[model samples]
Target: MEKFELDILGCGSATPTTLHNPSSQVLNIREKLFMIDCGEGTQLQFRRNKLRFGRLNHIFISHLHGDHCFGLIGLISTLGLLGRTGALVIHTVAGLENTLRPEIDFFCKDNPFEVKVEVFNPKVSEVIYEDRSVSVKTIPLLHRIPCAGFLFQEKQKEAHLLPDMIRFYNIPVRELAKIKQGADFVTEDGKIVPHGRLTIPAGPPRSYAYCSDTAYSEKIIPVIEGVDLLYHEATFADTDKARAKETGHSTARQAAQIAKMANVKKLMLGHFSARYPDNNILLEEASEVFPNTVLANEGLREKL
Candidate 1:
């Protein structure tokens, strides 16, 4: 089975610190690349991590905040310079295309790549995109602006043929396709062969959920329930609750609460405040509620 992987490009909060950059992450599922957010210096972080840029085709912007999307122009320009000729898809707010078109046009007039923008206004939660291997949906988040989280789910796979059963039943090569596709087969003599007699159920699909720059909102639980991996913002500790509320961000405890409520397999906490030079406080707080919490660091890669 193909696995889902996430690369943390930048984990710091609105401000950049010496040790961390702003919010940016990359999700690689079934060999396709999807970027969550692009903050300043994100391209630098990508290079430092030695990630291959050839497969990065789609980018999801969480909001219009600078910490979340300021690096987009630079990244697109870099992609053009790197000779990426394939069309690039950007999923963002309605006005974002107009906002970036002039700048992108000016920079890419001499380039050859195509940039396609897919707008997702925050009126509701819905499936925004679907490729052959995966589907992407939006989860409404409680941020200062009209923002949404992303859910990436791999498609269910076909059942694998049991080699022993194939040989034992003397299954014909032409019938192998039918068995793998979970279809019952009929013999040349009109004898029925059940699909269960030929194949077992395929494993559960893998999924990853991302919630960034949002305040504590339990409305997202259903959208991210039972996900294999979850990345949520933890912009402050519980002690700074007032500041967190004022900024429309969540504390480490709040992020953990969301993960626990959603029953996610693993939780990754990121978008840390610059004040906390170390992430132990956030991890410690989050792990108390959700034992599987990991502090997201710049260039950290997790294969799920």
Candidate 2:
């Protein structure tokens, strides 16, 4: 069976600490790497994790905050150093060109790589990017700036029949595709069969949602409903609720509440505040509200 995995690079909040870096994550789905947020030191974390920059073709920048996108310029420059000729697509909010374009041009005056940055003005939450393998959409979130979250839904794969069943039924090569597509076979003798009789149901498609540096908002529930996994920023503990609200960030309990309301299978809480000595309080508070709550640790890879 194929796998969808999330490689957590940095889980700390605005400030970088000795123990943790900033906010960067790599989603490894079906051999494709989608990067979410490229905070400072993210490239170094990528190196520590042994992830190749060539695999990162698509990038989603949640907001223009320095902690979330500061490392992007350096990463791109390194990609050029590594002789990456392939095109890189980045989906971000409008008005980023004013800040990002000049930097790219400054560093890549005569570079060979093709970098394409697409800005989406989301009026409402819906599917905005899609290919054969997966689809990505934006979710409106309440942040200090005009920021939004992202949702990634992997396309369901076709089912394959057991080898013994294929051999016993004498299924032709042409009929194999049909069976995998949930179609029953009809013999020349006019035999009738149901799709379920020949093949089992396909596994559920994997989905992930990323909410970074946003205040607790229920409006995003519809956009991330039934996601297999959710990564929500819990920049503060419940004791710092007032601070979280002032800073337009969510507490661990608030993040978990959203995860529970969205009915997500698993919840990953990260973006810890610099004041916190460790992530134990954040994890404990989130787990109180949602049992499947987990702290996003650096270099941790969770498979879905």
Which tens-of-lDDT digit does each residue in 1-304 have in candidate 2? 6768999999998878987788899998877889998999889999998887878899888888888899888898888888899999988888777887898999876667988999876446777688877999998888898888889999978876877777777889988888888888787788866667777777888999999878999999988998999999999998999999999999999999999999999999999888988889999999989999888889999999
Count of clashes in candidate 1? 0
Per-residue lDDT of model 1, residues 106-203, tens digit only = 87776668889999966578999998779999989998999999999888888887788778768899889878888887876888878888888888
Q: How many Å off is the CA of 184 in candidate 2? A: 0.8
Q: Model 2, residue 281: displacement in angstroms?
A: 0.8
- Global Cα lDDT for candidate 1: 0.89
lDDT leader: 1
Q: After aligning candidate 2 to the native by TM-score, how far in Å is the CA of 30 from where it should be?
A: 0.9
Per-model CA lDDT versus the true structure? 0.89, 0.88
Stretches of model 1 off by over 4 angstroms after superposition: 167-174
Sequence-dependent TM-score of model 2: 0.95
